[model samples]
Target: MKKTMKDQKMVLIILLSNIFIAFLGIGLVIPVMPSFMNLMHLTGQTMGYLVAVFAMAQLIMSPFTGRWVDRYGRKKMIIIGLFLFAVSELIFGLGTNVSVLYIARVLGGISAAFIMPGVTAYIADVTSDEERPQAMGYMSAAISTGFIIGPGIGGFLAEYGIRMPFLFAAAIAFVACVSSIFVLKEPLTKTQLAEIAANAKQANFISDFKRSLQPLYFIAFIIVFVLAFGLSAYETVFSLFSDHKFGFTPKDIAVIITISSIFGVIVQIFLFGKMVDRLGEKKLIQICLIAGAILAAVSTMISGFWTVLTVTCFIFLAFDLLRPALTTFLSRAAGIEQGFVAGMNSTYTSLGNIVGPALGGILFDVNINFPYLFSAVIIVIGLGITIFWKEKQLG
Candidate 1:
């Protein structure tokens, strides 16, 4: 029997909700981390290195995890990934030193590599071409909201003690894991499995790996990289920015991010799908990229918290629009090879994350606004690439 639309919607709801919860656990810890480490007497270099390790783990493991998803199935990966995530959160909650925290983060990265690609592939499997952008947009909004609330909640917890945030994070992950166990189901069709196997046989793994590097895929990759670079810089340095500019506390920064995320969510829910349908992916990407460049440049010049907050809402909305469009473009480029495409998507984002913070930290040592300028340049380059990017090659 064919499934009803309600069944498909339920699957989307369950998968996205679990993703939101998982991200919330990570987001909760990020804002208070430097403060937590400061209490433990770790230096900035140590903290940066610890964060780098997490990105490094994801970079190394994601391709293999993506392949496993193609071969094995989404539900299996989701369950195992959620269990690993819970274990990592447990370790993080009980962690006492920078080294222990590093271990927890590395494990968390591995678990995330599994879950993120698996969920994305699941979305690609179930949705039609027409619905893909909107569905992905919803998932992106869920993730952004998790970022919005998690830090505020973490900041409130941090007022008690440094360790409190991790305990809270662990509790969140456990709930997500439990929910996923019952709620998330594999969506792989028999035809889809056969197609993946046939593709696996038709093209040698090496050639397919190289084919995955298509020009259109590069367009998607550059967008992912540029977006991640900008956003990661914002995430890593925003606390410092708020503190220096406004003498704000962690909670204050949380409020600012939460407000910005509200804008992000609205754009994703209401604007992203319609814009993609109307403007098409190419035009949509180009417009968002240009807007993002302008926003980054403006952000460097802003001073007051209220002004920054207002500007940030628009900036995040630009980001929210870019994210789903680019993801849908990449998924289309994959066609039947959902795992490889989703894996590449995650890998580029992680690569950008790796570059963003390290570069932002270097620029920070020179000037507070340097990171924003750096982000603006990267965004402009991405815009140029979008203009020349070949869409026909993708399909």
Candidate 2:
């Protein structure tokens, strides 16, 4: 029993590490966006397109990847995803034109489609129902940790060159890919694999997706979408906003994001599970949405580095808590459809990512404060949905 428990812990660690590497690759580019814009001679709208393109590709691929993870097994897909991530980062690092950048973003999106659902389903496979929330919280923390570390490292590296960070991200992803190839084990047993194979043969994609999209799941999807949209809006324009408002350089923006993500990691690791246990997913979701809305509104009015940092920390903390809570809620509601539901969740999030940045970029071009105000309104709509949503509908 102790040996089995030890194995589980080891597997969880590897999974968490893999997720951390993937997110680190994504976040490493954030602090360098201003540099990219300058080099590419791009405007806010074009920059938005660059961000949205990645999510659009991910949105297109997520459902298919979810099914593929079940069919091909999680370990295989994860390694492939990591390899693709490395390729994408390398392409972006070496590219000289917008077309190449777009291609790289598309590759990144494809990688995420495979990685997100694969990692999520792998976690679900290894954890018992009771342990799932905490496990998901840990996963969220891993992601937040990547966000915390990536920007700081990228900022420091950007002194060398803007493109240097992308190269570093590629190197990190390549190492992760190699590690996954040798060290990661499939979580599913032979019997479970056979069962999943049988179910895959029996289930059509459309039917399975429809089944997963029942009213409760739909509400969960909306929450996921709203969270993604609001956060993306804040993030997409943040570098531009800070640069315009406070004359923040890439390093300054990186510091703010890194500090905000640090508090987020702490909240996810230490407070998220406890809050979920006490408040329940529904109530917690509501609370986070309300807090996020208020924060978004207040953010537009704030100035100075310290004040911005203080508000952003709370905003990120709320988002961190909201994510795990929503994941737990959806997972519990999913029961036998873990992979499908996880894929759908990613799809919803990708959809929001597609819309949010596009809108945010246009809004940022209009006025710096518009994006934040827009995000607040979106959060309020999500809150309204949550209020009217009946918990009993889940059954």
Candidate 3:
């Protein structure tokens, strides 16, 4: 059958569903992490390592996964990725030991490595350049929406059992997996296929990584890494920070996260595309980096409930805007190498995530406010790097 524009829209929705469902598992875990720390007798450092392990796995797999999506087809990778996502969530739901949780985290990271780049490349295949920013905005909204709902539901689910939300996440991922098998189609066109085939001989991760290191691409990857690192300083340590310093309950964490994420989703859906067009990626990135740095520092000083909530909302909003703007920038710059660039983006992000939380965890042990304060410093460094980035290079 000849695909209609409506059919293309349906495929995009399905692709976004894969992203939403995968991140939903991550969101579900955030609210219940303090309980997890208690259950497993974990330290701030160990918890930090736990988050890092996932990113480590992603970092290890992303270069390979990037090539796979281009070589094997986006549809195949999406199905396999979702299947792994289900299994990872299932393990997390059932495991009692930290070892088991680590294994699950590894599989979850691998699944993300497969899914994110595959979905991103698929969307790039189907959309025109003019349409991509809005399409990517909706994709970002799906991820934020997952975060919006998951923590709130996770807070309630934890009341029944700390493991309940993971099981629910597993079930939902499986459903998405099954639906993708039946419903999702490969959107790659003849031109993209030819480009993939041309890059086929040089398929090694080393070569791919080297290819991605061109002047135009290298700085973007650095920004992605720095962004993840800075965000992790706030995120991976957030629950522990709040519970220890402020005596917040799971529900309080849930309320703050869900509310903040809702605001992120609103701007992503309604404003992001317009903002990208008017401001351009470079300006949006610079603005958000400044916002993130200032807010991270500000977050360290605030302790009152309402004040913390306000700062956190801005933090989340800046990050939400920054991520898509970066992704849109890379996608526009990549030309025929969408999957390759997406994979590299994930790789750098994983590298940042690996380092950020692990360091933040150690710093958290020394001082409760240290992690976010450090994040402010990291984001300023990223902003400094961005000063070298010129808008004309993308064309």
Over 1-395, each residue of candidate 1 has an lDDT whose tens digit, in order, gives 43543568777887887788778888888768878777888887887787788888887777777777786778887777777787888888788776788889899899888888888888887888877888889889988888778877888898887778788777767777777778776677667677676666342345444655777576778789899998888667877867876688867676777788898898788878798888988898888889888988898777777888888888888888888888888888787777777876788889899999888878987998888888889999989887777657545
Ranking by lDDT: 3, 2, 1
By lDDT, the better pick of 1 and 2 is 2
Model 3 worst lDDT run, 10 consecutive residues: 1-10
Candidate 1 — which pairs collide?
none
| lDDT values, one for every candidate | 0.80, 0.84, 0.85
Instruction: List clash counts for every candidate, in order.
Output: 0, 0, 0
In model 3, where do residues sit more than 4 Å from their true spots? Answer: 1-7, 31-49, 96-100, 158-162, 189-194, 243-250
The count of backbone overlaps in candidate 1 is 0
What candidate 1 gets wrong by more than 4 Å, as runs, is: 1-5, 31-35, 157-164, 201-211, 245-252, 393-395
- Candidate 2: where are CA atoms >4 Å away? 1-7, 33-47, 96-98, 158-163, 200-212, 242-252, 303-305, 365-368, 392-395
What range of 10 consecutive residues in model 2 has the weakest lDDT sum?
Answer: 1-10
> Which pairs of residues collide in model 3?
none
TM-scores for the candidates: 0.90, 0.88, 0.90
lDDT of 3 at 254: 64
Q: Candidate 3's error at 147, in angstroms?
A: 2.0
List model 3 lDDT by residue over 1-395, tens digit each.
33443558778888898899888878888778889789878897778677778888988889888888887788988899999999999998898888998999999999999999998888877777767788888888998888777776788889998888889899999999999999987777657667776866556778878877888998888889888898876887898988998999977876787788888899899999899889888989999999999999888777878888889998999998988888888998987677788889999988887788779989999998889889998889989998888768756
